[model samples]
Target: MELYNWMVEPFQTGFQIRALLGGLLAAVMSSFVGVWLVLRGMSFFGDAFVHGVVPGIAAAVLFEFSPFLGAALAALVMVSLLELIHRTTSLKEDSAIGLLFVGMMALGVVLISRSDSFQGSLTAILFGDALGVSWADVQMQLLFVIGVGLMSLMLYRPLMSLSFSPDKSQALGMRPQLTHWLLLLMIAAAVIGSFQAVGTLLVLGLLIGPAAAAALITRTVPRMILTSLILGMISVTVGLIFSYHLGTAAGASMALVAILGFFLILTIRETVAAIVRRKRSTTLVEQGAS
Candidate 1:
């Protein structure tokens, strides 16, 4: 009876409800925008954006504000900074990204390391402690997810046009740059929402691997997105299960599982392609010899 009670304890905890909901939201949001990130060659941008919020998070902690607000402010600042760099500096996007990310990350580290309340929670914020999730956290996650979904739905035509070709999208009267900005903003929101549950470091895998894996398996953007959502959900669910059994952070475990899914896609695709090529090559050789 004691063992049964102990085994069921984690599930009964209020934190578990928060964690489940939060993880689900992160998975959904990450999967939604991830397809665009992969298509735009901006996978790293997701990582950069997430890491870029560290300083703001630290500041929020320092001032006793909600981490979400701080992270959002940091994201907006980074977006504006990138725009400024593009317009004013000769440094390209990659150079600007590198400079800004490192600088912000360093500042965040300093602030977090100095703040007592945020010290231990740093790990919770970074790698995620699903077991530590609160009602507020879960609610915040749901709002972001809903907001992003609405934006995507409302601007589907413009976003689709913008993604494939900026010039064409513009020709069609869609403001590609505006949509681009909006998309990045949504990505930032997703990152902030995810940061507390999954952390900055591991969120990249959630945003990248699932989408990339889906790409390998599917040809159309919608199909890719569907696959990504399914895969991301799988990762989260399996990760939660693993975390429960292994006593590890669900976020880290989920990220790892998603990465493994990426590799799994690659292996299957490569093996199938190799076999088809071999068969074709052998048939051609036999015909030639005959």
Candidate 2:
């Protein structure tokens, strides 16, 4: 009907199909990684990575290379720098993260202003408009998502162990150091994959919102991850539809809606629990009176 036509019309050409697929893939990949980021108390790091990638992404754009790879490498460099600073000095993780992120982001802005395609390149990289996606974009997202997914799946043991307790994991011969870097690499990959759909700015919604919401509603890591994926997809689909119809920013709308959905779920759960508690109290009162 009308809705079907709207959806199909945009995708009648291959370009739109790629855009759609890229977005969907980003949702899946980001949601999974977001869970870990939320659980590890490293939410800010993801945001930092988003900001920190500006210079690398800008450089890659100028060199006509893969901007996503450039962005990932840049983030890894920042992580390494943070680790070095933390180890070499008394600086806390938060302090280190703040210093590196701000410095790199400022440098990026300066470099970006010099590049002719800076605005356009950054717009696409930071907030995938979905309107500008090509087949190549879709292919890149697919490959990254699949590669990262398989990698994470295989390393689940070490990652989970490390997340629980690096000391314990290391004591148990798990190579916590190796696992730590691998987890960061996974996060970098997640952020890179989401660069086109959610953009670097809003992609954290995938890396944080879904996971936080899932955590609020679940007790186990696996359950949280599954819930995060579902919530992330819901955010993506709803945001896309609203953006398409209302002429709003798709990535922003999606992030807002996803966050709203988290609160909505919380409200509903609270209300239901309250009602159940009231009923239980009333039943107890009646029984005691009898």
Candidate 3:
């Protein structure tokens, strides 16, 4: 009975329910797009992409426009600049990413600082207000989930081929370049859709944590994606429960849970593997003695 009440207590209010729904939607979309980011070794790109949209979101907040549009435009600008630098300069992609990451993040701070409610707006954008999620936010996130999920499914083969071999993907007429752009768009969408729920900085936890954890436990992409979704949902639920009982910030709690889950699974996996190796070595020594 105590356990049941502990689980049910968080959802006793309307705002809490909305928060859960928004988080779940964010998780779904992040998992769908995050797997590709991990597979392509674009974790750095993912980090930069999230930060890249901050200026747009900050501008939207200051100018009284839709954040989604601002984020989308910012995403486009970031990608375009990245590509331009890559094509026009001798610097590596990482350099471009680093440049934009710092530039955009700094610009966002500058823009937000100009706001009348500077501290409040900055805090909300960076850390999020999970319990303050609205039904409209949930609705928008649902659309993102559906769009990202379907696009991920559609681009699976192309993305897989590209991850393993861009040359082969291109030779196979898979259009690796187009697929790469689409993946970027998906990542941007995931980040934009989720930032309101988890905040821009913390959203990276959901975007990479579950997928990275799943990669350790699952072999195939499909299995990894499935595992990531399950783990992501579990993190959200556990985080919300902890937030309710401990009076912690819900979004931070959820993001922290996702990140901690990855380390916990990694530790357990390594421990078990070590134990297995020790047992195998013992067996080999016994056989030699016999």
lDDT of each candidate versus the true structure = 0.83, 0.80, 0.92
Candidate 2 per-residue C-alpha lDDT over 115-138 given as tens digits, one digit per residue, 9 for 90 to 100: 787678667666766666677777
Count of clashes in candidate 1: 1
Q: How many angstroms is residue 21 displaced in model 1 relative to the true structure, after the best TM-score fit? A: 2.4
Where does model 1 exceed 4 Å of error? 1-14, 286-290
Q: Rank the candidates by lDDT, best first.
A: 3, 1, 2
lDDT of 3 by residue, 110-165 (tens): 99999999999988888887888999999999899999999999998999999889
TM, every model? 0.91, 0.91, 0.98
Ten-residue region with minimum lDDT total, candidate 3: 123-132
Top candidate (TM-score): 3
Q: What is the lDDT, from 0 to 100, of the residue 288 in candidate 2?
A: 100
Error at 249, model 2, angstroms: 1.5
Give the number of the best model, judged by lDDT: 3
Model 1 C-alpha lDDT versus the unseen true structure:
0.83
